[model samples]
Target: MGRGWRGAAARRTCNPRGPCCRVAGDARRPSRPRLSRSLSRRLTVPETLPSVPWRGPRHGRRVGTDPRRGPQRRRFVTLAALLALTVSALSASAPFDLASSGSDVAVEVPDPAPVATPEPEPEVEAPLVVPAATPVRVLIPAIGVDAPIEVYTDAMVAAADGWIDPTTHDVVSWWQGGGTPSSDPDNTVYLYGHVSRLEAVFNYLHSVVPGTEVTVVTEAGEIVYVVQEVLEPVGKEALPDDPRINAQVPGRLVLIGCYREPDQGRRRTTHNIVVIAHQVDSAK
Candidate 1:
């Protein structure tokens, strides 16, 4: 027989002794078959194989090895690449100012300009006013006396102290040193006349009652005064020192004249009469 016949007979032969018995008539088992070159190459593990962390069983699948994990793994890699590119682009576009952040460098910010404040207006003082009017005429309606007035200056005569000796009885005399007829309440205008002289301007002045209105005309205009008082007769000797006859007190108008007593006769004048009035109205 050929080798094939021998192999067939070997397979068919049985040992009379059990499987562990080595009997004299037993057929030897055929030698183990050897793999072919191609098959061996396919089964052999490569020495240059890439290293991989060992995972058990199902977890041992490499990235993209499973059909479900293939697309997911590719998307993850793509997203990572895009995120890196975005970060790099942002960093390049907006660079930090490293030089200004240094410890030795100083940054300056300008102060705001001050607001313009307007200055306050200056205070202005009023001008001082000096009155310039002088009495030109006198009128006492209650006594029916109206006469022109003349400013009698004491400096006109070397020996005269503003006292006038009337040459004519038709005119009245005003002292230049006395106050002018004005709106000033503290000032008093003085007028002097003689009742003892013939046809005197103040001949009927003693007859003027307390309620009479007196008008004194000046270059400015007429000033009206209501009689406030008819003073008692003052002796002629005490006339110079009498405060009633002077312009020192608060009076608008004052009329002074020699007083004649009915018992003392008309020609003999021992005392003087004073009439005081206050300004009521004026027309300028």
Candidate 2:
């Protein structure tokens, strides 16, 4: 009996089916066949399983894989992509310092100081007063009328050698010359007298023709005029309206007189003869 019991103990140790053996008596040993059968069944099934609905991290549910580690790997991949894009963009842009390439560089520069311009001065005009000329000598060769001309006032005329007509009663009205007191140096010097009545005065003035010579002495100098034109017309219609006639261009003289008629009474009635002459040369 003792030997049989010892043999049974030894067989329990070697035999995997022994009842009292530790390895054979393990409770998980019964599931070994089930694990092998499950593995065989998994091999026969499809490799892919039906997908599960995913929820965000706020929920306590966990992903089959580690959720934190998956998002970290995706973020690392996105960062790598962004870094690559930034490097490519920086390489495509233009470089600075283009002046060394012989091309013009646009840079702002300030302007220099401006120059000042000068204004013109205003003009000054002369005063408005009648200018007086110095009296020179008068010459009338025909009737021995050569004499010195003076500013003959009424007192001077009464005491002068020449006599004025009693009818006209005018001393300055007899021998006329010079312009209005308002005229300038270039004004006309007109002379006039009665031809029919004054027998010694302007009776020979009618005989004067073109190229006739007449002499005048002025304070400035002596000037001689040659007859240029003779005009005869009745009444005021004979006068020329041109103001240039008043403009005594350098040396000019105009002589005026009334025509004579033996039948006409003392009551004056005749046409006026105007002779225009220009200076040829100065009498030295």
- Which candidate's lDDT is highest? 1
In the range 1-284, model 1's lDDT, one tens digit per residue, is: 69976566555444667575443324565555799999999999988989899876775677656798777888999999999897676555544443444433345759999999999889865422324478888888777888899877767433454345555678788877677876553577778887864577888888888779998888767778889889899887887788666647644788888887766654677788888888776655
TM-score of 1: 0.49
Candidate 1 C-alpha error for residue 40, in Å: 99
lDDT of each: 0.74, 0.54
Score candidate 2 by TM-score against the native: 0.37
**What would the per-residue lDDT of candidate 2 be over residues 93-156, giving only the tens digit for each residue?**
5253433544334455578878777777778554433343443554656434454443434453
Prediction-by-prediction clash tally: 0, 0
In model 2, how large is the Cα lDDT of residue 244? 39
Weakest 10 consecutive residues, lDDT, candidate 1? 97-106
